[model samples]
Target: MIGARLREWARRHSDKGRYTPVGIIFHWVMAALVILQLALGWYTTRMYAGGDRLTAYQWHSDLGLLILFLAFLRFAWRMMVPGPINDADKGGWQTNIAYATHVVFYLCFFGLPITGWMMWSALGDGRPLYVAGLVPWPQMPFGGLDPQWQWAILDWAEDLHQMFILILIILIPLHVGAALKHHWWDRDDVLEGMLPDVKDADDHREGLTHKPKRPRSPRVTGAG
Candidate 1:
């Protein structure tokens, strides 16, 4: 009795697709960009402590600004259009982890840039960070204060920024693994929603002249 009611509810709302897998490709692409930033950030830190001297701090500053810009774009994108629910429709631990990890990801990615902005704004190495020598972005200005304490605070912020990136890198594999598992093990196209140029189910249905099968696919899959 309860199962039948759940089925009816799903049928009614299934036609209306969610925000995920829209025309935007930022979901996957930005994620890849973040991972790349993490590696560069780590290398930057090592060089900051007199590792390479000339080239050490240079890349770090540039990447930090890039991180700031990317975070702004990513955060805006997320708010503009929340991603669709799991493609597999298994809104259990998988859903919970995916959501939680993403929130943490945002925090780490955004925190680094804002802190970096503060760092550069205060103690710039005599020059500014720029993109393509085309535009000069202003850094946040903190009024006159003790130089010693300010440097200490900036150091800590950068440390935490690196720590969070490390945490996120570890979680990414698990997150991606789950998405693929849905297609490989569960045989679901939940992953297809965000994949480029996928054939929407509704479109596939339009071409079909015959009625649907008893089960949605080869077998009954998905927990909810």
Candidate 2:
């Protein structure tokens, strides 16, 4: 009975304009992970000397897999809990662009890792992929393909992976800029909707109304 009530409470909260706690947590966590993954990838490409270079690649692979798993969970959560609604008053083109950007973001979340996995499999180097040097991860089926085809596919996957990464590099800034523009220029609840502690516009207005006002100063009438 208590469990059912708790779930009901959670559902009600998640339906509000602002993001639910779970959603907020997932958003920030994924943002940090993606940034880290980008850094690792960039560094690994530049460094080509020692065992440390190999270690960097391993870390990048493990992190990419972890991100893919989290992306799946985030997608499931999004399906279960509808995100905050957009400003109904906004222009149609703006809204459509926002939605399209989100679709691309989701695609990158899934595509990048899958391409990376395919590239790894096509290498067919016979080395096990260990997650953080702990558990062995199975390679994709392409590892069994003939050498020429595997290398060709590997080149293709690498190109796709790089393309997706570049797309993310461009999109992330635009996404952030749009949110900030909404919050600062438009003075709307768009950005706050994703934040956990900040109140939405309606709640903020409500808070202002309920807040106790300071007593007014007495006016002097002696001159009159």
Q: Which ten residues in a row have the lowest lDDT in candidate 2?
A: 206-215
Q: Give the TM-score comparing model 2 with the true structure, all chains together.
A: 0.81
C-alpha local distance difference test of each model: 0.61, 0.79
Q: Enumerate residue pairs that collide in model 2.
A: none
Give a tens-digit lDDT track for model 2, residues 1-224.
86567556656654454667888899999899999999999999899778999778888998888888889999987776666664523669888888898889889989999999888888888667765456678998876688999989999999999999999999999899998887766666677667765434554564332222334556787896
Return the top candidate by TM-score: 2
Please state the error at residue 204 of candidate 1 in Å: 6.1
Candidate 1 local lDDT, 171-193, one digit each (tens)? 88887897787656765546555
